[model samples]
Target: MTLETEFERVSMPLENPFTISRGTQTDAENVIVRVTDEGGMTGVGGAAPSPHYGETAETVEAVLPDLLTAVEEIGDPHALHAIEAELSTVVTDNPAARCAVSIAVHDLAAKRLGVPLHRLWGLDPSAAPATSFTVGLDETERVREKAADAVEAGYSILKLKLGTDRDRELVEAVREAAPDARLRVDANEAWTAREAVRKSEWLAELDVEFVEQPVPAEDPEGLRFAYERSALPIAADESCVTLSDIPAIADRCDIANLKLMKTGGLLEARRMIAAARAHGLEVMCGCMIESNASIAAAAQLAPLLDYADLDGSLLLADDPYDGIPMLDGEIQLGAQAQAGTGARPKSVE
Candidate 1:
């Protein structure tokens, strides 16, 4: 059936500074897409650009108008393969923007089909677990306080933002604050090969479950080297963007951090996971700071993953739509049964 398209930019304030190698952000601006087929079924999607991945809100916003224009021209949500193929030509290389539209289309199609997104992708929705909450970059005391707050809020798993002058100290402090919580750290490609090795040693002492993107994305050799030396499992974030990037990362790292924006959409992300498993790499689905719409899309892929960082919705002060309900770190899929992308478009008129 033919579908209509609408687009907008939504800004959500972060609870604290989200810092990584690229810069710091106090607010998250996401590109939002809505698709409504002639059948009256609708779906919503959101795209958030990560500066660490070399994208900004400005770039994401700049690509949306053209993306909406292209999708409206195609006018068919069910013709996903055809529409996606056409999108590549018009949208080009902006995966974040493409992801927004892809998710919205998927939602619309799924809603029309009357099935949850996981079932559409051949997954059992009942098996999906809760996601992890991220502890943003901050001072040691403040980071510890945030960790405590997350724990108090019923978060079972906590991912800490690390990779600075005081990486070790921060981890130790966070661990001390939330001793029972499962802890993991992400450097966001800030460290050197040598520093990764050194930090991995200290990190091992904190009993961290894994360390993500400890070194720069380009240094596969460094990742391999660190993997060989560290007791902690290494998760490749920036290092593994596409399916082709998986084989090398699987050989070098233990886990893969799959972000929808990085792979473009669920289609590519599914392929990337298959490739990662063939090479014995564990999968962890993650997302940039986004609203419930984007987080809901990523949650559909959560059951297939060993780890989940779908905490983007938790970071927002307000989420306009109740797209996905997260309870005590666990994603409550039962809250929305008909998933076909799980996000419903906001009212444009």
Candidate 2:
């Protein structure tokens, strides 16, 4: 029987300013996709705007209507693969929107099969430990304040967003703010290869665990060069999007940051994780600013990943759905299993 598909937008305001190399954000607007089967089981998914990656509310909104129409025309929720194939043909760009629709389909499919999303992805949900919370770039005092808040809130690991001129100062302030916390840094491809290596020297002094996307996405050679020179482990973010991008980045990066939006959906993300593991790279599950829908989708992959950054929902001032509870800095997998990842808003109907 054919299923029904619908789309809408949810706006989540950030508790504080979220700044990166691309831009700053106070509110996170996400595209929410809902899929309902003939049996009445439903699954939800979210796609968050990554302005740095050229995604925005307007762009996602524009893309979602057509995507939903095409998917609904296909009707059969079980024909997810075929539906995704058809979707690729219609929506040529704005992968984040495609990802949202794809994830919703996967969630609905899992529900229909009477299995959790993680099991469908071939992962043991219990294996995913706590995720890391991010501290965006800010003044030292503000950085410390945020770090302190996260630490006090029960997060043991903190990912400090750096890459600008005051990288060292930010790290130091975070360190002071959360003395015993496990700290790491992400450059988000802001540094040149040379600058990455140079900055690594200073970061090493702060005992930063790893540095993510220190150089631009296209500079695999530079990434390798920086990896060789730095004592800190390098993680590939933008450089490693699809499974195809894995082999090239494997030798250069010690870790890979996987996001649902980048991988398109759980099926592809599972494949990417297996490939990354085969290449002997650790996996880090990350996310853009989103509500429970997006976080829940990524949570399915959390058990298999070495690091977790599913703090997207936690940063929001208000979340429309009760998807997963991120307590302290760790994601409560047990809670996730009980609640399931794809919890939809009651208003989604």
Candidate 3:
């Protein structure tokens, strides 16, 4: 079947200025992708490029022509394996761009089959864990307010971004604000090994569930040092990028954090999850700041994940697209009545 393709960029402001250890973000840029089958069945997807991973909206737009060109050549959305394999060769990097195409193709394929994307993979929707709402770094008081707000909004789990000298103060404030919330912290490669180890102790004291990417990914030995000594379970985000990195990180972290934008496609993401399981690592699926276009695709994998941080779409001040339903932070994947990834454009004013 012949296919058609197109993409466009969108800029959306965050509800709050989102700050992490490395920096703050007032807005996010997403590149949206679409693939249409011969019968005019259209699939939608998006790319939320991360500068930390060496991608931006500009780069994603720059590479889509070639990636979508490969899809046109292949002429079939059902040939998921062949298309994904070809995408890798078409552009060795720009995973976020490739990811957009992958998502759209998968959406179209599942829609064509008259099933949701998760159903296509045979995943049990009820197995999905509640997603964690992120409290980006801020002054201790503002951070506390954010935590309180998240809890008020019915987020049962909270992932607080930490990396300042006031890390303890921040955690304490959040812990005070969200006493019963399942807590996780991500340092974004900001801490030293010793600092991570030390912080992990206190974080555990606050009843935190885990710490993520504490030490710089550039330091494997440091990660090992922290992982061996930390009181809380450690999740490897920056340290784990692909299926190849899974085995290497197996011994260094408790959780293997996977991002679709980082992995490039749904097939590779499944492979990473399997590889992580094989290596005895707990699996988490996180997302970059995004719209429902890509977050919906990520949510389809929630059933396979031990942890879910697919709240990227939730962080936006407003989203042009809506995806899977969420009730008190639990992803309602089965509630997605539409076929494919279950993303649809929100009504415009």
Candidate 4:
């Protein structure tokens, strides 16, 4: 058997400027990857690198050729373990690039079996959590308006970016607009332990479900302090990057937030989930600002997550590829009739 591999860089504008504690993004740059088997069947995936994680489109592009070379060398879609293991040897740090190939290989393997990705893994589609639409950091009024728009668009869960002097005011604005929506907040490591504990009390009063990454990953003790004192549960994103990090954070945070770009691939993501659960931490899956090519792959693991923040594709102004159907904020993995990850060119769909 022979495999053919190719990739392209794509840039798409966001619906609006997306800001977090770290910075803002006006556009999402992704590297799309495709791998084909000898019989002409193809798998699709993408890499949406985050600069915060020390990756960019250029880095993803630079690393993919080597990763894809490894995929083709294996020439077996079912050899995911071998392909990924080899990919790690090729480039250990470029996880997003490895993730793209990981996704493609998984998609291809599922397609060969003629089953949806979640189905292939025996996950119940109904078990998939409804994804939260994020309200990026912005002017108070604008943030309120975005929340209203999300409710109007049928997202029942809303994750708000909170990491500023006016964090309370910003969250209040969103609550005023989305009184009934399930709310979660991400500070993106902007606050000290004392400040996080203080804010968590008021945020709880406003019915926030949790506080995510209030303290930076570098300060593990701060995270533990906040977790011990905060009124609301804390989720660790920046703090929990890999399976190894899970043990360290298990005592510090209530939730373990995993992302494909950070984990490098699907198989490792599941392992992380299990590890988090064994450590008695609730698990959540999040994503970078991305297109459906990658977000769709993340959705496949929705059933395994306690909270789903897979709204990356929803932030895009437009996407060239269509993945799973997400109607009314619920990730409808079974909604797709076609096999694989439900990612294909919009033209093909």
TM-score of each: 0.93, 0.93, 0.99, 0.99
The local lDDT score (0 to 100) that residue 316 gets in candidate 3 is 97
> Runs in model 1 with CA error above 4 Å?
344-349
C-alpha RMSD for every candidate: 2.3, 2.2, 0.7, 1.0
lDDT of 4 by residue, 1-97 (tens): 8999999999999999999888888999999999999889999999999888899999998888888888877889999889888988999898898
lDDT of 1 by residue, 1-349 (tens): 4667777888888877787656788888887888887867777888888765667778877877787777778787777787677767787778888888888988887887788888777877667777888987888899999999999999979999887788888998899899999998998888887888888887888888899988887888988888888778999988888788987777789998889988877677888989888999899988888887788888888778888898887787766655666889877676665557665544554
Is 2 or 3 the stronger prediction by TM-score? Answer: 3
List model 2 lDDT by residue over 1-349, tens digit each.
6677777887778888898866788998887888887777777888887766778878988888888887788987667788777777788777788888888887777777777777666666568878888899887899899999998899999999987778888888898888898888999899999999999898888888899999999888999999999878999999988889999898898998888877766667888989999999999989987888878878877888899888888888878876766767656656654333656664664
User: In terms of lDDT, which candidate is strongest?
Assistant: 3
lDDT of 3 at 349: 72
Q: List runs of model 2 lying over 4 Å from the truth.
A: 337-340, 346-349
What tens-digit string does per-residue lDDT give for candidate 3 at 1-349? 7899999999999999999989999999999999998788999999999999999999999999999999999999999999999999999999999999999999999999999999999999999999999999988899999999999999999999999999999999998998899999999999999999988888888899999999999999999999899999999999999889999998899999999999999999999999999999999999999999999999999999999999999999999999999878999987999999999889887
On the 0 to 100 scale, the lDDT of residue 83 in model 2 is: 75
RMSD of 2: 2.2
Candidate 3 versus truth, CA RMSD in Å, comes to 0.7
Model 4: ten consecutive residues of lowest lDDT: 340-349
Alpha-carbon deviation at 35 in model 4, angstroms = 0.1
* lDDT (CA) per prediction: 0.81, 0.82, 0.95, 0.93
